[model samples]
Target: NEQISKYAVQDPELEGMGTTCVVVMLKEKEVFFAHAGDSRLYLLRNGKLAPLTKDHSRVQEMIEKGEITPQEVLSHPERSLITRALGMENVLEPEIGQSFEAGNGDKLLLCSDGLYNMLSNSILEQILTENAAAQDKAIRLVQRAKDAGGYDNISVQVIEFQFKEQKIILPTTPLNFFEKNIDESSENISPTIPKVVKEKKIVDEEKVPKSEVKNTFQPKPEMSEKTPPAVKTGKKVPDIALIVLLVLFGVVLTLFFLGSGMTKDPKPSELNISQTPDTNAVAEPMNEEPLDNQQETTAITTPKKDEKPVTKPEKPKKIPKDTLISYTVQAGDNLRKIAQRFNMKTETLKKLNRLDDNEIKTDQKLKIKVRTVHTVAAGDVLSRIADQYKTNRELIKKANDMTDNATKRGTKLIIPLAKAE
Candidate 1:
C-alpha cells in the first residue's frame, strides 16, 4: 500500500486507480495461483464446484466462520466495500496457493467480485458442463452478471482442460555446454507423458494420439536452445592417446643418449692404404735410354710400405648417473633459499621448470642435480660406501681409483649418485 500510494501521488494516470491481480500458471497436471483483493478462483471437477481462492473482503471472512448467513451477505449494505486493494496506504499480505492436479473435465474459473456477486455455483456449473468453450463461456458469464444489473465493470476467464488437448511438459534443468553434451551421449531418452486439456484447438489436433499407445514416437524438441543440445562424451579418449604417444617419444630420446659412447670406434675403411691414395705425389719422367727403358722396367716404387694402424683408446663405458641432492621442505623455504641451499643459481631452478620467474610454493618438490664428491672416513670402507649408496662395491672402487677395492681414510672420491628410490 505504501508503494501504491506513492505511485498514485507521483503518477498522473494512476492517480486514483487500483486493481486486484490474479495469475495462474499451468504446468503439466498442476496449477499454481497468486491473487490479491476480492477476485476469486473456482474449480469445477466432476460435478462439484469448489472455491480455490479466498476473497480478501471482511464480509466473506465473517460468512466463512458462520458469523453471517449467505443470504445476509448477498444483500448486505457493506458488501461492496473492499478492505484491500493496490492503492491502499498499507497493503495486507497476499495469498499464494499450492498446485493441484486438474482432472480431464475440470473447469477453472477466475473472475472479479463484480461477476461473482451476482451469480452462484449452480449458474456457473451448468454453463461449464454444457461443453461451452472457455472464451465463449467467459463472455456469457460476464454478460449474465451485467444482465442482472452489475453496478461495476465485470471480468471473467474460464479455462477448461479437455483430454484431447492434453500436453505434459517434463521438468527440465539448465545445463552448461559440457553437461548437455554428456547427457545426449547416453542411450536412454526419457519420454514425455501426455497432458490433459479440455478445449482442443484445431492446430493441436496432431498432438492427440500421444495419449494412446498407437503413436508412442512423438517428435521431441531439440536439446539446443533451438533445442537443448545433447552432450558429447567421445572426445576424451583421443586426448589420452596423444599423451601416451608424447611419453613414448620422450623415452626414445632418453634411450638415444644411452648409446652415445658405443659409436666412438673408427671404421676399418679409414685405415686402408690403397683406398687412401696420396694426391700430392708428382711423377717425373725417368732419364733413361730407350733400349734400357725397354730392357727392364725396373721401376723402383720407393718405400711403398704398410703403415701400422694406430688405435685410439676408448673412454670407459660407465653409465652416467646424475647425482641426487634433495632438500627437505622447511618453513620459510622460498625459491631463493632452496637455490642457495644447493649453491645453485636461482635462474637454473626457474629454467628447469620453464617458469618465467623464480616462484616456488611451500611443500613443492625441487630437484637439485650436482657433482657428488665425498671423503672417506674411518668407518667407511668400499663395501660400506657401496651399501650406503645402494650400489655394488666395484663401482665405488672404480670411482675412487682404488685398484684393490681398498681405500685409505680421508681419500676423496667422485661418486656418481642418484636419488633414492
Candidate 2:
C-alpha cells in the first residue's frame, strides 16, 4: 500500500516523508520493544501468538475502537500513514516497550505493516506453529509479503530466546562502589570516596570466564536517580594540583617577608660610603665588627642607619566593591573555559545568565556571575555533568526547567549549582 499524508496532518517542510521503525531489547528471558509510527511487534509463546504494541496511526486506532474491520483497514486511503515521529516534537514521549517473559522455546517477531497488511492472522499463526527457526521464519515472512505484492519498505526481526548455562558473579558492595566511582569520575575525587573496592572470595577468579568479569553497568534512560560507574584511567585530579600550588605560593611569601626583617640596620663604616671613597673602603671592610649582644643602654632609635629598610606595599583601595561582574566573549569562547579561569563551574555561570548552552558567538557579552551556561559534550550524562559542577542532577533539572534527563550532543545547558561539599 502507498503511504499518503493528508494536507491537514502534514508538516509544511516535510509533508510527504514517512517511514517505519521496529527495535527490540532482550534481557534474558524477558523482551522489550519500543516503537513509533506504524511499526508492529508480535510474540509467539507457548503455541499462542499476540500483538504487543499498538500502531500509532488512524487506522489502527479505529480498529481498536471497533470502528473498522480488518478487511476495511487493508484498503483505507490512510492505511499506511504515520501519526507520530521521533524528531517531530519539542517534547518526545516515546511509547515504552512492554516487557514479557519468554518460555524456553519462545519466538518474537518484529515487522513493518507491509508483511501483516496482506497476510491474515490465521495464515501467520500456521507458519509460526511449524517450529521454524528465527532465520526461516523471517525469510518466510519476507517471501509472503513479496508474493502478495510488496507495496512499501519491508523489514522484520525474528528473535528466539533459549536457556543457556552461564556463570554469574555477584559484587560485594554494589551501591558503595557505584557511588564512589560516580564521585571520582568527575573533576576531582573527594577524600570520602573510597580508593579501592573490597575483595570477595565467593566467585573464584580462575573459574570465571574473562568475558564474564564486567565491572561496569549501563544506566537506563528512564532512571533519574541511578548513575553509571566512572571508568578509572589513573589520571591526577585538579584539587591535588591546587593544593600543591597553594603550598608553594605560601613558602615563597614567607621567605620574602622574613628576609626583609634582618635588613633593618647597616654597619657604620658601610653606611659612610662617601667619606672613605678609596683607601678606607678596603681597610674599613676588614675593621668592621659584629654587633655586641649585651649593652648597658639599649638602642631604641627608630632610624638605625642612613639606609631605610624595605616595607610591604599597601593594597589598592580606590576601587570600591564591585557592583557587577562582567565578561566579554572572545573568539572561540565557551562557558566551560571561562568558568574554569574564574574558579567557578559552568552550571554556576549558566544560572547567572539564564542560558542553556555555551552557544555564545564572538564579541558576545556574558554575565560571568549573574548567569551560567554549559554546553553538553560527548561522554556527558546528567549525573556526571552535575557532579563536575559540584551539584546533584535534581538542581540542574530545576534550573534548566527540564524534567526529562535526555540531553543531546552539543546541546547548551545551564549550570546554577554551587559547591555542595
Judged by whole-model lDDT over C-alpha atoms, candidate 1 comes out at 0.48
Quote each prediction's TM-score.
Answer: 0.37, 0.35
**CA lDDT of 63 in candidate 1?**
62
Tell me model 2's lDDT, rounded to 2 decimals.
Answer: 0.47
Worst 10 residues of 1 by lDDT: 269-278
Pick the lDDT winner.
1
* Model 2 lDDT at residue 148: 62
Q: What is the lDDT of residue 185 in candidate 2?
A: 75
- What C-alpha lDDT do the candidate models reach, one value each? 0.48, 0.47
lDDT of 1 by residue, 1-421 (tens): 4466677558643443457655566654466665666777777777666677666554564565455565565444334434345553232334556667665667788888666656666777777676545666777777677566554456777777654333433223232322456666654432221122112121211221111111112222122444223344332337765665566445333333432332211221111000001112122223433321335456544444585555689874333334433232334567776554444567776665455766554323345543443444445556766665456665444433345755543334444333222
